[model samples]
Target: MSAPDRQSSFGIFQALRIRQHLVVMAIAFAAFALQAWLFQHRLDAPVPPILTDFNDYHVVGRMVAAGRAIETYDWPTLKLEQIVQTRNWSFMPWAYPPPFTMLVGLLGLLPIWAAYLLFMAVTWLLFYAAMVRLAGRATIPALFVILPSLIINGKGGQAGFLSAAFIGWFLVFLRERSAKAGWPLGAMIFKPHLAAGIGLLALIERRWGAMVRAVVLIAASFAVATLVLGVEIWPAFQKGTSTASEYLWTGFYPLERMLTVFAALHRFGVPAVAAMVVHLTCAAALVLAVALAWWRKARTETVFALTVCVCLMTSPYTYDYDGVALGLAYAMVLPRFVARAGRYELPIAVLLSWIATSNYLWSGLRQYWYGVPIITHEMQLWTISPIALAALGALVIVVLRRPARPDAPWLRAYSWMAGRKPG
Candidate 1:
């Protein structure tokens, strides 16, 4: 075939690919719209489950705004049952720190319903904007609409969307504007566990400026919160933390609802101590992986993706919505995955995508399928952790096999730090 013939055929293929992507995006958006509408109407229910988590934030926010921050943490004196009855809201222990309470208090200024919608909308927008900036416009469908985590987060009114958005932008700016990256890293203080792995990775990479800025920002946030809410809030939070930890271990929170290594093990009838040991071991391994990747000067994008995955793996408390960060990680490495499409990579990608979106489907099946319930309730949430672990393993393999581009800036920086000549 002539060169012109080959070029024309390639152009046709590209156009076809674009059209296919557009079609998939259209379907996803339509599905999301329907879900949103159903959530709003709640059918026959007076209150939709979408407000479950948000109500906690809204109530706590109102309490903080009304100078009742201390009461939020003082479970015994707070009379949570009475408060719930008065407010007509669900019971949710206020486990977050004072800094988070301050932010929530601002949202409390609005009506609960309006605050819930606005919070979700704002976080979704931030997530989309960060994703577009990092992965480009073509990747929006996969990260924003198709990912089941976003849907879980939207419905649950969880902080996962906001956390994922912060982490996504942090990764985007980490290499080029290291100091500026601190802002998003600091913002992730609301869910400190989610940011723990990345924090360690930053330390390993000797990103001192970013680390220092993040520390200062976080400290300032806490300090400001203390000044506004009073120092007693910290001790109250500490007590709440202890209570929360006990609740987690005693199975007060259903194992079927938690998507963590510890919960997965416990669901299988492992002793609580043994499950915790396994969980800690896995968390350590994930941290080590990130440290090793940083030491080896792996590609910045690859390291960032790994950091996100490791964060989820290590976190003691993770729900389906928290997988939004995992989706962002997948989006980060997607361009490279496309460039070097392997036989196994496509299948793995498809499998992980399905797993990310399977929480609700799995729950429904467990509830309605008699056989499923007979098998085990733990299987509902346990299924997510293994798939995520496998995906992380696959990601690590890909990163190790793919050498850094010689001219990548991070490679040069690493070389200088190690006293080696930049190749």
Candidate 2:
């Protein structure tokens, strides 16, 4: 009844919540320990299944070292390199653009083990630093929230960290200046699909300086990759994409492993045309939401977070490891969402999302490596997509329902964008 009594009760409840978060984090750390051990254990095998994707990165890097960088796009040649280098094979092909090929090709300059460690080490540091910047005051909690995705990315030795870190920097910088934002956007040339959505977001928001810089950087990178690797690399990469998708239609990539609505629908035996229609429809809706969010002048963080969902939904080949950007986006927005909702359920939903993005790595390890039949292909096709849809809807709803504060300095991220004048 008294104000002092109520204040005391609120403090106590807050303390309780903090303690609960710590406990969950402790369990997560323990799980991470086990996961690290499992990754190490798999490495003892002559051809570890865990390295299949990384093998693609490393072997292609080796191709560059051996003066055959462009050949990485040659499916048989790349597969042969994997067989020779790591004695493992992947159904996935090397569809990365030349700039990324060159980056990883430099990794081929090192021994496989050293390359893996060094690549992970550098990117791990950048990823943490970038996420810290994104999390701002919520750095510690954000780390825990993204820990699952971090584990999954590390386990598979994927480029999730590098790509996600780029995204983190892009979001942080976009709020500061338009041109400065383009640097990270350009760096994402390695994964152009991911960058494309973000680029479009800037375009819709009318961040012209950023758009110019990103275009220049992208063009320069492509020109350099072309000069160094040869003109043939372009066609090779395209042909490989065609080859891979043919396999995809035949179920080479399991729907459970992919995080797109198209994959989920196709998994359930929907017709290919129907699946594409559904996916494109969802993508259109999300992109439109992002445009509207920006037009309404929502905070930069909220808009960028929504953009992440759109990128994942629009991409046909996103995997659990590739969900790192989404995970980091969730972490970046969690504090604000919690503050605004002033309730428990939104946080819980976010946590459930982390769980959803995390399980694929564990499930694959169990079924393919550890001989445990815990999760099967038939069961998880719908796991990650629903979260993407839900997050998009929630963000759009919140953006529309609640206007940004009148005094917020970031009324517009780019003053020159869309004819806005400073106060």
Q: In angstroms, how far off is 116's CA in candidate 1?
A: 1.7
lDDT per residue (tens digit) for residues 162-250 in model 2:
88888878877776765788888888888777775687777876888887888899999999988888898898878877887786666
Model 1's lDDT to the true fold?
A: 0.67
What is the alpha-carbon RMSD of candidate 2 to the true structure?
8.1
Residue 365 Cα positional deviation in candidate 2, in Å, after optimal superposition: 7.1
Candidate 1 C-alpha lDDT tens digits along 1-423: 687986776565556545654564466455545554554454226543433576567667777778888888865544463345233434356788789888898876876556766787678778767776776533543463236776666666788878888887887777675678878888889988788866776667677788888889999999999999998989989998888788778765545655678877877778889989999998888788777877888887778777887777787778777877776666666545544445455456656666645565566577676554333333433445554656645664675466545544344333332223334
Show model 1 residue runs off by greater than 4 Å.
1-51, 75-91, 141-146, 339-348, 369-384, 395-423
Q: Estimate each model's TM-score.
A: 0.78, 0.78
Residue-level error in angstroms, candidate 1, position 345: 5.4
Give the C-alpha miss distance for residue 55 in model 1, angstroms: 1.9
